[model samples]
Every structure is written in C-alpha cells, then in structure tokens.
Target chain A: MLIHFHVNGKACAVDAAPDEKLLDTLREKLQITSVKRGCENGDCGACTVLLDGRPVASCIFLTVKARNHSIQTIEAFGEPGHLHPLQEKFRAHGAFQCGFCAPGVTLSAISLLNQNPTPTEEEVRRAISGNLCRCSGYVQIVEAIMDYVEERRAAREEL
Target chain B: MAAMIYPHDSCGVSGATSVFLKVDSDGSAVLYSGLSDVGQGSKTALSQLAAEILGIPMDKITFIAGDTHTTPYDEGTGASRTTFFCGHCVKEACEKARTQLFEAAGRMLGVPSPEKFYIQDGVIYLKTFPECHVSVAEAAHASERIYGHPILASATFSSFSTPADPETGHALMFERHTFGTQIAEVDVDIDTGEIDVLKLAAVHSCGTVINPNLVEGQIYGGVHMGLGQALMEEMLEREDGSVVSNTFSEYHILTAADMPGVMLSGMVERPVEDGPFGAGGMSEGAPSPTAPAVGNAVADALGIRFTSLPLTPERILTALKAKQSSQRS
Candidate 1:
C-alpha cells in the first residue's frame, strides 16, 4: 500500500505494508532515523511523532492511519548550528543522557508547549510522562521544559 | 522520612583502561577512548578533562569513543569507572601531548629548556619572557612539518585490587570507593496500601567533580531507577519458568509523572589522592541508597520492619491485616 503524508513540512509518499507501523515506515521507507525504535508497543513513547501537531506513539499507529495526516519528527525542530530554543535549553539543563528517548520526549514537550505556552512543572512532567528516559531521570527533563517556558515568557514580556 | 547510606562502582573493572590523544597541525585535537557514553555523558566529561589539560577550547577537541578499530583497548564503561579510570588515562595522554607541544614551541622560540614553557588557552609562552610565545597551531605545524614529529600520546591506567582468598573469601577489592546518602519522605495509606513519595534528597561524596551537570544527571537518573525497584518493578513467571512481565507495559519503570515534586541533590567534593584531578567514580553510588531510604520511610510510617523488595500494595495490606489480627488476639 502507498501512503501520502507531509513529513517535516515536506510532502512525501512511500510504499508500506498494510500492517506496517508508522514507526517502521518512517524509519525504513522514509529513512527518518530520529523516530527511534523502542518498545514497539504503545507503552514506551520512544517512537512518538507529532501527528497534526499532537504527539502520538507511532509504533502502534498504523501507517495507513497516517495516510493523509502530517507528521513531524525531531528533524523538524531545527538543523545543526540552528537548534530550537527548547533544544538549546535541554542541552543547557542537561535534560538527557544516552538520548535514545530524546526525539519522542522533545516532541511531546513541544506539543504541550504548542497548546499551553506556560505549563506548570507538574504539567510539564505530565506532558512527557509517556516518554520514558532511563538516564538523567525526569528531573533535568522537567527543568529544561520549565526553563524553556520561562524564557519564552520573558521574551514575550519584553515585547 | 528516612535516611540511608550505600556504596557503588562494583569491583575494579574500570581500573583497566587506556586512552589515546592526537594533536593535529591545525591545533585541533582528537581523543580516542574505549569508554562508551551510553547516556551518562562520559564522552563529554573525558573531553573536558583533555581540554583542561591541553589548554584548548571544547570545540577544538574532537572526541572519538568506543571505536574498537581505531581506539585503543579499554575495560568498557561500567561500574562508574569511566570518569575515574578513563579520566586518568585521558589526562595522562593529554599531558604527554602537551609536553610534546611545549618542546616544539621551545625549539621555535629558541628556549633552552622545555620546562620554561607553559600553555594557556592554546597559546604556549615562555615563563621567563611571557612575550616570547606561539599559538599551539604554529608549534604543531613546526613540529610536524619541520621536526618530523607528530604530536601524539597514549596512556593506560589501572586501579589496584587482589583476588579473593579461596578458603577465607577475603581479599582487597576496589582501589577507590564513593559514598552517598539519600532521604525519602513518603505518605502511605493504610487502607489502600498506596505509597506516594513526597520528596527525595541526596548528598554524595564522589571526590572531585569533573562535570557538575553530568554528575547531577547521573544522580537524578540513579534515583529514578532505584525508585522503580522500591515501589513497583516486578517480573512474573509461569509454572514452566517462562518470563511473563517481559514488555514495558507488563514490566513498569518510573515515568516523568511518577517523579517526586521536590527532588533535591547535593555533592560533597573530597579530592582523591591518586584520582584524575582528584575525581573518582560517582555514578554507581547514587542509586545504591535510594531503595533503602524509601523502604525505611515506609517502615517508619507503619512501624513495620519490611525485609523484602517492592513493598507492593498487596504486601503492605497483608502486613497491616496480620498486625491487626495479632493485636486483636
């Protein structure tokens, strides 16, 4: 079967199996490696991707289910030498170790910020709760998200 | 609330490792180490050690790690030994490379002795005449092109230990040791047998801190792992002995939502005599005391001495009911 989806704002069409997961299609067919292959079940959010600007576990999500919807991966955030503010904050706050869960965690946090620009610490924790990070715990991850929120708030105040 | 202490960095596996450093004519340096950074940022920490010794910016240093073909042999990156054992190896290699660069700079400056030179921010200068100096790039170029010597060095480090006695089961183990303490505060419901950890605080002595952020990162991560063992991580099996809780859904680990609202961490730096920059292995110790601290908290809350792990709700409820029956009898 063939599926058409906009990935990172670029229109793409790829052949996928009828029962293929969006995770394998994106990784194998589209060659988007940022969408890591973790627990293929919906439990571990390592395969999370933004579908219509909301985070979803692509591992269990069928490729056919994402035929027309736009998908976003960590590549959409920013390229090398031009990182998103959130990415910069994550680096500064030491939010990750190993970085296997970074893409899903980052997208989840991004989706939360897209809806609520100023999320509380608890809210931030809840946002990336599905994305499990074995390293650094969730302390720095929460700190990074809150720090990004604060920076944006400060910037808006200056405006 | 309860307090507990524990130790980490098992055995002396990290003690046997080596690293290689190469300084190019462009003044950029490359570090090769067998240590792997699974996520704990040991590569960055090792690079920082090299940069500090070489007097170069972090960006100028390219770190290549865990490459079996190109890099030298290493004992691997576990037991929290990368920062201590591999750190010393990187330090030694960088120091040797620094000496070579100083010699080349000394020859270029007509200095009689290389000992009269020192490096600062990638620039080598004469101790007597500070003005007589050259950039690391210039010295490296002169040494490689003119003197026909490429600036490179390698070092191996090992922590001492003796095999256990077969008869007595006694032996000197682990050359270095790290210590830490953790405190956990929890609220337990007697009826529901649910435990909510309100806060967690930790203090550690890991000798000198190579990287504060990475250290904190390790502690936070270690505590999270320990919490899973304390509260809910379990594996089930059938009568035939096949695993049941094999997947993430069945075998649960702590997620972000499970973290305590207040997680505080502190470090106590007491330099090790023979450690690299007075730093020792710090990562393994953080997780050791977390389970004990939490278990103690639950014990204190119910005035019960629990000897087993997880302290699952069913176990708590069973213990409570047994206590009630005993009191009634």
Candidate 2:
C-alpha cells in the first residue's frame, strides 16, 4: 500500500506492504536506521518515534496505521554538523554510551519536552522508563533532560 | 588499553570508533560521534572532553550520535566502553585538530609552535605569552586559507582484538572490568513470603562520572531494574521447558508505585589512563549486585538466606516453615 506522511519536515511517499511493521517501513523503506529494533514485541521502546507528536513504539504499530500521520525520527532533529540543543545537551551530559537505544530515547524525551518544557526529575524518569538502555544506568540521559529543562526555563525567565 | 570495538574502537588506545569534531564560525562546537548514548552519558562525557580540550563552554558543544547508518561504527554502546574507548578516540581527534590550530596561530604570532597555546571562548592563546590570541573559527578559516584545509579531525577506533577468538573465547574475557557492589534491604512478610525491597545501595566503578546527575539517573534506573529482578521479573517454563509466562501479565516487572528505595555509590578507584578522563565501565554493575543484595537484605529483614531468585511468598513461607521444622529437632 502507498502512504504519505510528513517526515523530518518534508513531504514524502513510500510503498509499504500492508502487513509490514512500522519499524521495517522506517528502516528498510525510508532507510532511517537510527530507530533500532531491540524487542519487536513492543516491550522495549528502542523503536519509538513521534506519530503526530506523541511517542509510540514503531515496532508494534502497523505501517498502514501511519498513513495519515506525521512521524518524526531522530534524523529530524539535526544532522551531525547541525544538532538540536537537546542532542548537544545529551552529549554535554554524556547521556549516551553504546547508543543502540539512543534515537528512540532521545525522541521520547523530546516529545515530552515539547509538551512540557519544564519536567521534574521523576517526570523525566517516567517518560523514558519504557526505553531500555543497558548501559550507563540512565543517569546521564535524565540529567541531560533536566539540565535542558532548566536552561530553557532560565532563558525564558531572562526574556 | 583495549582497542576500540565494533562501534567505538573497543580494543586498545586506537580503534575504529569515529569521533568527529566540528567548530563553527561562532566559536560554538559540535561533536558528531558514532558512540551510542543509550543512557551511559557517553555523549555528555565525550562532549566534555572535547569542550575541555577545545576551551569551549559545555553548552556550546553539541553531539550527534547513534544513527547507526550515519554515525560511526560504535560497538553498539554496551559493555561500558563508550567513555573508556570512544572517549580516547575523541580525545585524540580533538588533540590532532588542536595541533593544526596551534600551528596556524604560531606563524601569525612568529612562534615556533603553538604547543603551549590554549583554546578558550573560541580564542586560541599562548599559555606563556597570554597576549597573542586568535578565535579558533577564524584561525581555522585562516588556516584553511593558508594551508588549504579546515581544522577538522576524525578518529575511528575499534576494540584492539581480533574477531577470531581462540577456542575458549576467553581472550576477550574482559576488555576492561567494570566492578560494582549492591546492597539490598527487603521486607519479607513472614506469612505471605512476599519480599519488598525497602532500600538498596549500589556502589559502582564505571569510572569518573562525566555528569553526576546523569550518574544518579543511572542509579535509580538500575535500582528499578534491580527491583524488577528481585520482587518480580521472571520467565516461566513447563516440564518440557516450554514457555509459560508468555505475557506481561504473567511475567511482570516492578512498577513506580513499588517505591524501591535506592542509594547510589561507587568505587571509581581511578579512570583507566586511556579511557575517558580515567573513567571506565557501566550498567553491567547493576544486575550482579542487585540480586545478591536483595537476597542478603531479605535475610537481614526476615533472617533467611533464600537460595533462589524471586523468593515468592509461597516459597518464602515454605522455607520458613522448613527452617522452623529443622530448628525444632
């Protein structure tokens, strides 16, 4: 089946099999490989992406279900040369290690920040709980989000 | 020093892990590396190393990571190698670029080399003279104009071992050992045998923390995983080894309401010299310490060293009854 959705701020079209999982459509059809396949049963959020600005596990969603929505993957954030502040903040805080689950986790945090620019530590924890990271204990990832929230708040206060 | 492995050269000092450093015209720096930042703080730690060496504010530096196809071949960001191995490759990449920066500033300043120069606020300055200085972006552009290449550097690190293993597969027993200890405190209901982890203390040695807040995040997250391992989280099988607990309803993980108390501690002794700022290791410290800690803590609370995991209430009660029967003799 043919589907159309806004991806990374651009209009694109792709042919996806009706039974194809969203993860396969994104990785194989669209060729966006940042969202990794950790547990395809939707237990791990490694394949999380923004479906109309809400974070959902791509592995569980049917490719056809995404026909009319806007989806955002990690690539939408920024390229290697030009990075989103959160990506930079994530780096400054060392929120990544072996990075396999990075894209989904980053996108999840970004989705939360977009809705609530200022999130508490617990909020950050709850938001990212589904994304499993077996490295670095999730310390830096949460800290980076917390720091990003504070910085944005400070900037807003100054304004 | 184990070289960089699959993603971040995971072997020795030099590996195929790629750390890309790019400084903008405005003194803002962005680092793009293949390192996975799946919660280990590798992005932040590597950025700190680059920002520290480049003399830029941590906020000014950004990281682009973990897009497997686009990002460098990092070892998939596991086994605590990001900071140790990837950090070195990044450090070297930055150092290699720093040389060109200093060299360019030297010719303009009439110095033999900018060896002792420092990069600050995007400005390159002589450590000794302190008077002669140049903005890194401008100097880099100037260097490009003069030497025909921008101030850019790349490092690809791989774990320094052969993929082919001797029969034992022990040659890579531990590229580097990340040690840790966990202490668990549980409340075992004498009747129900249900164990509640009242509190937990986890001491880790993943090396120097690139970010304390981030490390704390790791602790709590790990504690939750530990909590799941202790009170719940198990796979069920039948007599023929057929799967039984095939769903979340059957095989459960601990939830937030469980309110498992946690204390994060560590023994970083020292960062491996080649590793990121002497930091080494990661979440592998979580599981090992957790089960034992919970088991010991439950014994402390109810006075029984239950031998198996997931000391369910039925098992605990049966064991308690058995212990009492044994004591009666």
Candidate 3:
C-alpha cells in the first residue's frame, strides 16, 4: 500500500506493507530513526508519534491508517544547534540517562504543552504517564517540563 | 534501610575491565572500552575522568563502547564496577597518554623535563615560564610525524579478592564497598490494600561522586525500581509453562503517574583510596535499600510482616483477613 502523509511538515509517500506498522513505515521506509521500537504492543510508548498534533503509539498503528495524516516525529522538534526549548530544558535539568525513551517522552510532553500550556504538576505527570523511562525516574523529566512551562510563562508575561 | 555492596564479583573473585585511549592529532581523544553505559552514564563518567586527566574539554573526548575490533577485552559493567574498576583503567590509560603528551610538549617547548610542564585546556605550558606553551594538538602532531610516537595507551584494571575460607567461608570479597540508606513513607488503605508511596528520601556515601547529576538520577531511578519490586512488578505464569503479564502494560514499571510526589536525595563523598579520582561504585547500590525501606514502611503502616515480594492487594487483603479471623477466634 502506498500511503501519502506529511512527516515533519514534508510531504512523503512510502510504499508500506498492508500489515506494516506506522513505526515500521516511518523507521524503515521513511528513514526516521527517532521513533524507537520498544514494547511493540503499545505499552512502553517508545514509538510515540504525533498524528494530527496528538501523540499516538506508532508501533501498533497501521501504516495504511495514516494516509493523509500529518505525522510528526522528534526530527520535527529540533535540529543540531537549534534545539527546541524543551530539549534545552531537558539538557539543563538532566532529564535523561540512556535516552532510549526520550524522543517519545518528549513528544508526549510537547503534545501536553500544546494542549495545556499551564498544566499543573499532576497534569504533567498524567500527560507523560504513557511513556516509560527506566532512567532518571521521571523526576528530572518532570522538572524539565515544568521548568519549560515556567520559562514560557515568564517569557509571555514579559512580552 | 541501610545497605552495603562490594565492588567486585560476589563469588570472592577479582573482576577486571579494560580500555584503550588514543589522542588524535587534533588533540581530540577517543576512549575504546568493552564496558557499556546501560543508562547509568558510565561512558560519560569515564570520559569525564579521561578529560580531567588530559586537561581537555569533555566534548573533545569521544567514547566508543564495546567495539570488538577496536576496543579491548572487558568483563562488562555490573556490580557497580564500571566507575570503580573501569574508571581506574580509564584513568591509568589517560595518565600514560598524558605522560607521552607532556613529554612531546616538553620537547617542543625546549624544556628539559616533562614534569616541568602543566596542561590546561589542551595547552601544555612550562611551570617555570608560563608564556612558553604548546597546544596538545601541535605536540601530538609532531609526536606522530616527527617523533614517530603518537600519544596513545591501553590499560587493564583488575581487582583481587581472596576466596572464602574453606571452613568458615570468611574472606575479603571486596577491596571497596558503597553504602546507602533510604527512607520510604507510604499510605496504605486497610480495606483495599492499595499502597501509595508518598515520599522517598535517600542518602549514599559512594566515595567521591564522578557526576552529581548522574548520581541523583540513579537514586531517583532506583527508588522507582524499588517501588515496583515492593508494590508491583510480578511475573505471572500459568500452568504447563505458559507465561502471562509479559508485556509492559501487564508487567508494570513505575510511570510518571505512579511516581511519588516528593523525592529527596543526597550524596556523601568520602573519597576512598585507589579509586579513580576517589570515586566508588554507586549505581547498583542505589536500588538496594529502596525495596527494604518501602517494605519496612509498609510493615509500619500495617501491623503485619509479609515475607514475599510484590505486596499486591490480594496478599495484603488475605493477610488482613487472616489477622482478623485469628483475633476473633
């Protein structure tokens, strides 16, 4: 099946198998390695990708179901020398260790911020509950996201 | 809860790890080691050790993990020995390469003795005359081209331990040990047997900490793992060799929603001898005390002692019912 989708804001068409997951289509076909293959049963959330700006587990999502959808991966978040503020916050806060689950967690956090920019700590925790990070225990990760939110609030107040 | 871990093989035998350090012409260094960083940041910590000895920025050092063709033989990372044993190996290799680099810089600066030179930010300067300096890159280039000796070294750090006595089974199983203490506070509902860990505080004396951020991260992560072991994280199996709850959804790890609201962590640096920059193994010890601490908290909350792991609701409810029945009878 040839599926047409916009990935990272770029129109791409991939010849994917009917049974292939969106994770396979993005990683194997589109050459996007940020979406990791972890717990392919959609429990770990390591393969989270944004479908129409909402986070979804790409591993269980069928590639054919993604036709005409606007998908976003971590590659769309930032690039070298020009990191997203969340990435910068993650670095400053030491939010990750091995970082296998970082991309999906970051995407989940991004989706949360997009929906609720001023979420409470509990909301932040609930938002990223789908992603599993074996390292850092989600302490620094939550701190980073909250810090990012505070910075954004401060910046907006100043503006 | 308090605990101590020996930084060696538990069977009263020495453990070993190896590393190869190569300083390039650009003053950049690459550390090839068979030891890998499995989310504990051992490679970064090792690179920090090398960079500190070589007087180069950490960014200038590239760490390659477990390359069979390039890296030397290592026993791998375990028992929190990566920083303790492999770290010493990295320091030894860096020191050897630093000696060669200083000698090359001494020759380039017209100094008689390499000991008279000091390195700072990849620049080697004469201690007597500070203005007389040479870049490590320049000296390394000259050492490779003109002197025919590139600054590179390989080191193997090994620990020795005496086997247990044949009669009493008493022996020095480790030369160094890491100690930690953890406190866990939990809220348990007597009816539902649901446990909610309210807070976790941990303090560790793991000699000199190589990286404080990574150490704290390990403590937090350890608490999560410990919490799972205490309250959840069980492998269920059906009869006739069938496995259930094998996936993450069924086999639950600590998620953000399940995390305790307050996590307090601290480090105690004693700086033991023979360690790389007086650092000790802290990663493995981080999770040791957590399970016991949570268990003690649960025991304190409910006036009963549960022996087995994963104090699930069913077990807790059964224990409570049994206690009630015993009291009534």
Q: Highest DockQ: which candidate?
A: 1
Model 3 per-residue lDDT tens digits across residues A1-159: 788989999998888888999999888878899999999999999999999999999999999999999999998988779999899999888889888999999999999999989999999999899999888789999999999999899999998
Share of reference contacts kept by candidate 1: 0.95
Off by over 4 Å in 2: A1-159, B1-16, B24-30, B156-172, B239-242, B262-269, B300-303
Write down the C-alpha DockQ for each prediction: 0.89, 0.18, 0.83
Better of 1 and 2 by lDDT: 1
> Which residue pairs clash in candidate 3?
none
Ranking by DockQ: 1, 3, 2
lDDT of 1: 0.87
Residue lDDT tens for model 1, B1-329 = 33433333334533578888889999999998888878788889888888898888999999898887988888777767777788888999998999999999989988858788988899999998899999999999999999999998999887666778899988667666777889999999998998888999988887899899999998999899889989888887889999999998888899999988899999999886588899888887888888899988998899887888787888899999998999999
Model 3 RMSD, rounded to 1 decimal = 1.9
Taking all chains together, each candidate's TM-score versus the true structure is 0.96, 0.65, 0.95
Ranking by lDDT: 1, 3, 2
List candidate 1 stretches off by more than 4 Å: B1-15, B165-169
Query: Judged by DockQ cut-offs, is candidate 2 incorrect, acceptable, medium or high?
Result: incorrect
Residue B41 of model 2 has an lDDT of 64
lDDT of 3: 0.86
